[model samples]
Target: MSQKDSNILDLLKGNLVKGDKDFELTDEECIGFYFSAMWCPPCRGFTPKLVSFYNKVKCQGEKFEIIFMSGDFDEETFHEYYAEMPWAALKFDLSSIKDTISEKFNIIGIPNLVIVDKAGNLITTNGRGAVLKQFGETVSLTWT
Candidate 1:
């Protein structure tokens, strides 16, 4: 693995979650950092679409995962919003980690989807667009 990729995985330590269980990032072909908040209407609207894409990928046995970086006001709100997602999330207490990620990706807005390949090279910061265009086609062409 590249240094960048290794660093990202290290940075995410102790902050990942899947369902009610803690999970680790391992062997994903690609990763998506979804920056969003429950209070944001646009974020709420886009989340389900992302979820649909997530489900489709899972059903097809794609090696991908999305990690939510919550911008919610509190941990309770973050947990409530996270419960609705089918993907993993960064814990709310890890605000510094979230902020670092956001700044690293130049995320200035909610609902921004930044995707990285297995090697941790950024595939696209406009994952929302990729998700909208050609669904399965996008996965094969752009993500892997």
Candidate 2:
């Protein structure tokens, strides 16, 4: 997939961190914005499930990536929460960008997962549901 989505790229580029290294988006077919927080019990419950699904799809060689967007109250909390994720996350300092993404996606609650195609166009807002129900057995194919 080509990095044709400039807006989306701008929103995410240079702001992703995975473990101790800087992360970059690859030529993936799509990207998933996982809006969640450490304080939300529901988010805590769903995050691991999503991470498992993410890892499973990755192991299957799926060309997709998930970027965690924290809803935490502070950077420390965001960092602490993000550390458990296997995928990359938005920068803790770029809180406005996170809010922009959340508003753009019309996210009214935590544990919202939105998928966007390579062109930066939204593919689905019910990503959590899709991963859990629609494509539980073949989660990777859900993006394709």
Candidate 3:
């Protein structure tokens, strides 16, 4: 495998939670790394919007997936926040991995969505903007 694929595998090695079940990454054309927290008011507001967007694209059978990277202070908060999301999340116990990902992406704030291609190449760091400004099909076209 390439270095980028190796890095992605290391980062996403652990269990990913989606609702009550564990989720595995597959042949998604795009992956979104979503950084946010329950304590952040902006995150609280944006989460619902993102959920809607996710559902819309998913219903359309788009090969897209989002992996939440919680910034919550506790596991309980992380669970609470994650319950409202429809996508998978890095386990709360994997804070070190999350930190590494945050640093790699230069994440400076909550509610940030960084999009990457299947090979782990960056598609856009301004994914939140793309979601907000474009429809699901438009966003997919831009990313892919």
Angstrom error of the Cα, residue 7, model 2: value is: 1.4
Using all chains and alpha carbons, the TM-scores for the candidates as numbered come to 0.89, 0.89, 0.89
lDDT of 1 by residue, 15-114 (tens): 8989888988888998999999999999998898888888888888888999999999999999899988999998779888787777778999988999
Residue pairs clashing, model 2:
none
Candidate 3: list runs displaced more than 4 Å.
1-6, 135-144
Clashes in each model (backbone N, CA, C under 3 Å)?
0, 0, 0
* Tens-digit lDDT string for candidate 2 (1-144): 322323765778788988768998978888999999999999999988898898988898888889998889898898889889999898888888887788777999989999998777899999988877743475664642
RMSD of each: 3.4, 3.9, 3.0
lDDT of 3: 0.83
Q: Global lDDT for candidate 2?
A: 0.83
lDDT of 3 by residue, 36-107 (tens): 999999998888878888888898899999999999999998988898988999989988778877877899
Better of 1 and 3 by lDDT: 1
